[model samples]
Target: MMELAVVWSVLIAQTMLALAMAFALYRMARGPRAQDRILGLDTLYINAMLMLITFGIRTANTVYFETALIIAVIGFASSIALAKFLMRGEVIE
Candidate 1:
């Protein structure tokens, strides 16, 4: 059935996102430089957002989608701040 296919696909997507998150964590932890670590954090947030999206699809819930949106907004703002800090040694002028 279509429902079964949807469930299975969402399960697979979630599994992949989990694996990606693991890799991102490793990169963030062991990165030799600030830029590499920042890149890892960026990837981690994106995977987290996608994981939430897959959960929303699986559960047919709107809350997961809204939470994912919040994560995305916060992640983007944090990444910009980090980049600015790395470049100028200050987040704000």
Candidate 2:
């Protein structure tokens, strides 16, 4: 049934997101360089956002979509700051 397929898809997506989050956390903790840590954090953020979207689909609610959008904007800002810091050795300098 279509309903069953949707459920399965949601389940699979959540599982993959969880795994990705775990891996990102590992990288963030173990990265040898600041840039690697920043990249891991970005990946973690994006994966969390996707996980929220999947939750929205499973619950048939729009709130998660808004949350995901906010997360995306915040993630973008964080990545930009990190990149700037890498380039200048200081975020504001």
Candidate 3:
């Protein structure tokens, strides 16, 4: 019964994450300003990472966790680059 409950919870979490990603995508595509689009992209990546972590938990696997960590690192870097570009018109000095 506990296992069944865990499975159902994971399923529900994944479904919600998918819905969040879809909304983020819509914002990314339709945002009127660059900042809004960047925010949407950031949200999308964060949700993807969370979904991966949930998958890892559901499967009791380290591989999914590692992948999620990588995604988080990449997302953080990209968000920084984007913010720098927005402020200075370039990512690197």
Candidate 4:
């Protein structure tokens, strides 16, 4: 039953990832301020990247790991930029 356990684990991980994504989207849409929305976006991207890693494991595709890393870097950069803008009143200020 090892094969069945593996299948169930993958399925459960995927479902949890999907629910996380949906919650992030809801937060993004309902957030009361720009910073909150940006935070939600960052959360969504991070969760998506993690979901990609899970998919990679399930499908035995190493390429997805690289993609997830890239997405994580981009998400971090965007969050930094957004936070800076919030503090300075302008992106470049």
Candidate 5:
């Protein structure tokens, strides 16, 4: 019974994360401004990272956690670059 409950919970969480990702994609595509689009992209990355972590928990595996970490690092770097571009029109000096 407990195992069944765990499975159901994981499924529900994954479904929710997928829905969130879809909404983020829509926001990114339908944005009225660059800032809105950037925000959407950041939200998408965050949702993806969360989904990965959930997968790690469901599977009781370290591989998924490691992948999520990599995604987090990449997402952070990309968000910083996007913010720099927005503020200074360039990501690199």
Candidate 6:
């Protein structure tokens, strides 16, 4: 009974995350300003990480968790770089 609930919850979470990702993608593509697009990209990365976490929970796999961690690190760095570039017109000094 509890296992069934867990399975259903994970499925629902993944579905929601996927929908959110789609919306984020649309925003990133359609945004008129660079900042808006960057915000959308940030949201996308967060949703993607959560989706991977849900997959790890559903499958009892560590790989998905590790991959999510990698995505987190890379996403954070990239977002920072993008923001800095937008502000200064370059990523590095």
> What are the lDDT figures for the candidates, one per model?
0.96, 0.95, 0.96, 0.91, 0.94, 0.96
lDDT of 2 by residue, 1-93 (tens): 999999999999899999999999999999989989999999999999999999999998889999999999999998999899899889885
Backbone clashes in each candidate structure, one number apiece?
A: 0, 0, 0, 0, 0, 0
Model 2, TM vs. native: 0.91
Judge candidate 3 at residue 87 and give its lDDT. Answer: 100
Tens digit of lDDT per residue, candidate 6, span 33-83? 999899999999999999999999889999999999999999999999999
Once superposed on the true structure, which residue ranges of model 2 sit more than 4 Å away at CA?
none
Candidate 4 root-mean-square deviation in Å: 1.2
Cα lDDT tens digits for candidate 3, 3-89: 999999999999999999999999999998999999999999999999999999999999999999999999999999999999999
Query: Candidate 1: where is the Cα deviation over 4 Å?
Result: none
| 20: Cα error in model 1, Å | 0.8
Residue-by-residue lDDT tens digits, candidate 5, 10-86: 99999999999999999999998989999999999999999999999888999999999998999989989999999
Q: What local lDDT score does residue 26 receive in model 4, on the 0 to 100 scale?
A: 91
- Kindly list the per-residue Cα lDDT of model 1 for residues 1-93, writing each as its tens digit: 999999999998889999999999999999989999999999999999999999998888999999999999999999999999999999999
Off by over 4 Å in 6: none
lDDT per residue (tens digit) for residues 21-59 in model 4: 999999899998988899899999999998998889888
